[model samples]
Target chain A: MSAFWIATIGTSVIAFVLKYSGHSVPERWLSHPKIQRINALIPIALLSALVAVQSFSEKSQLMIDQRLVGLSVAMIALFLKAPFPLVVLSAAVSSAAVYHWL
Target chain B: MAFGAAAVANGFSVLQACLLSLLTFSGASQFAVVGVIGAGGSSISAIATASLLGTRNALYGVIMAPRLNVRGFKRVVAAQVTIDESTGVALGQEQRGIDAVKKGFWYTGIGVFVFWNLFTLAGALGAQAMGDIRAFGLDSAVPAAFLGLVWPRLTGKFERILAVSCALFAIAMTPILPAGLPIIATAFIAIVIGMKR
Candidate 1:
């Protein structure tokens, strides 16, 4: 199978397993303060890393271009507490303009 | 819906994106899968990052299982839909009593599932029709979406700093490591801080 298929199916199965495990496992096992604290931070770390990777890097190389403007606009929109859709829309619009015009 | 478009923009087939929504159903993990693979990361990297992002669902399941109290086929179905929205709604209805909780869980869970899948299909089809997503700046939309997802979670100053630091750390690691590994490496920072406190 292709890498995409493998990742898709494999990740899905694992995600289901993680969900099911929570249902079946004893509450105390997962309720530990340390565990919960770590779990909460995991997404924060992964997502921030994703933002960096997506905005700054292009494949194996780091390239700065229109995406940076898009991300900056996103940050400003986020700071202004614009709705999620608006944030994405503003970023896309600004980035596209930069890509085409500059 | 954005996921559908983003997935296609990231090089996934419409069927693949739909399957992700149907099966995985977790937004962050699904996006991570597409993003990692699109960036030429290995399947292992994609799965690892996605699975790590999905750990919260298990926590949500733990909170919901007792409140739900189902059996056999129903239990399996309940597990599938045990997401943030369902659990949050179920908990929010706590003052109303058990019936409200159950109703909240089922209604919200199934509702999100149906709409989320439908929108995924729509977004995928729309993005597919767009042809050359880069021209439309959808490439930046992917990261912007990630930022949106994480934005609400940064509720405190420390969390905000940690997130920014992690972003920089990943960027610093980018030149040295492969595509997805930098993201994985940031988990250690969380672990260390988590251990310290």
Candidate 2:
């Protein structure tokens, strides 16, 4: 009835189509050189953009705050090859500290 | 992260958040939906932005299809849980042989589906009780988890450069673009560089 419901249902349908179509398409097309390259790189680009936006932006404006501090800490933990949950915990703890102290 | 945001920022109900996780099963796209709605964007914009971000899962599907041959109803189940965690775990188990790969995919996919839904409900309820999500710094977990996901993949010089450039490109576009569009725009960078290489 509402736009929110419609959007939710629409997103689900779109996701299903995308996933099922992956099986339906000829295997050759999915493995094209260009497609493979794009596939390899898209995750990196998408995840990096997610990190940047989540860290620095507030709504539509570019603002920095505790999130940046959290990200910085998480980046270091990641660089050290820490466990995944530990990296997340380090970031959350650092962010909580920033929120409390700064 | 997203379920928490949906609860605190958008004032979404527990049902709404859980249904979203169940149906979409995409962390990024679900977050984009809430971000778009929280920013007062139209539903069209919300769905469009979410779909654009989800296009990558389709790519994942392509990569996983040959690796996971299925038929009939099993295809539907596989399609539902074909997410980053499942695909990543599946590929990581490639060395152990085909059985291991299948086990990895099913275990991760089912595990994430179950846990993600359960935790979404928990996060929604927690946000409802806490009243303010900022103090806990749960908001930052979205990006932090993303960073955790992407970092291990960037083992080489070129991947590192591409990832850094894309992060900069996304940040630079934040002020100019709408809430969810900046993330979507990063795909162009990958496309261009992917073409060049």
What lDDT tens digits, residue by residue, belong to model 2 across residues A1-102? 776777777877887788778766777777778977887787788778878877787777888899888889988998898987678778877888889997
Listed in order, each prediction's TM-score against the native is 0.96, 0.86
Note the Cα lDDT for every prediction shown: 0.92, 0.77
Cα lDDT of model 2 by residue, B78-189, tens digit: 8888888899999999999998998999899999999989888877787677665567777676678778877877989999998998889988987887666777677778
State which docking tier applies to candidate 1.
high
lDDT of 1 by residue, B73-163 (tens): 8887888888878988999999999999999999999999999999999989999999878778888988999999999999999999999
Q: What share of the true interface contacts does each candidate keep?
A: 0.79, 0.68
lDDT of 1 by residue, A1-102 (tens): 999899989999999999888888888889999989998899999999999999998887889999999999999999999998899889888998998997
Span of ten consecutive residues with least summed lDDT in model 2 chain B? B1-10
Q: Which stretches of candidate 2 lie over 4 Å from their true place?
A: A1-7, B1-11, B35-49, B93-97
**What lDDT score is found at residue B60 in candidate 1?**
91
